[model samples]
Target: MHKKQKGEAAVITLVIVMILVMVGGLFFGLPLWNRWRAGIGGEAELRQAEFNRQIATLEAKQELESAEYLNQAEVLRARGVAEANRIVADGLGGPDGYLRYLWIQGLSKGSTPQVIYIPTEAGLPVLEAGKR
Candidate 1:
């Protein structure tokens, strides 16, 4: 009877130690498992980036080509405008002469006949608003 009781006691002690080992392992291993999962996710993202690299490069190239074409078109337009201005300036004698020509043309066309009033020495118009 004594020997049987000793065997039973030994079995109970072994079971308790096994349970403690399993619990301790679970406590320490969870963080390591999560870290490994995150590493796998990062690797997947890297693979996706690698897959799209050629497409990204082609898109950038297309954008740069389009910008260059547009810039050239704008330069051509500006050159045309400048040439027209130069021709008009030469025909009119200068920019100031062109402006005076425009003023006279405006005066001739309008029916109401705009009045030109010279400013006095005080830099005010000839007629003040409240003066009789």
Candidate 2:
């Protein structure tokens, strides 16, 4: 009877020890698992940040190219206008020639001015249609 009681007490102590070891292992392993999951999430966030930066750089490059093209087009348009003005100036002999061209252009129109002043050496006035 004494030996049987000793055996039963030994078995109970071993079972309790096993339960305590299992609880301690779980307590220690939970933090390590949480840290590993956080590391994975952090790595994913870093990759997303890099992707966003690359997209921003690409957009800036495209915008710069568009601006350069617009500037070139504006310069070309201005040069064309300057060239046209030079050709017109060459066709008209001088200031008086340009004035004569304007007079001819006005005459070609249907409407005429009632009082017209023609520039001469003395600045004389020319009457249109009927003038008193």
Best by lDDT: 1
50-122: candidate 2 lDDT, tens digit per residue: 9999999999999999999999999999999878766766789865776778777778883755466666677
Candidate 1 on 1-132: residue-level lDDT in tens?
999999999999999999999889889998899999999999999999987997899999999999999999999999999898778877999998878777888888888945676688999877644445
Per-prediction TM-score: 0.43, 0.56
Cα lDDT, model 1, residue 83? 94
Q: Where does model 2 exceed 4 Å of error?
A: 1-22, 94-132
Best by TM-score: 2
The alpha-carbon lDDT assigned to residue 56 of candidate 1 equals 96
Q: Which stretches of candidate 1 lie over 4 Å from their true place?
A: 1-48, 101-132
Checking candidate 1 for backbone clashes, the offending pairs are none
TM-score of 2: 0.56
lDDT of each: 0.88, 0.85
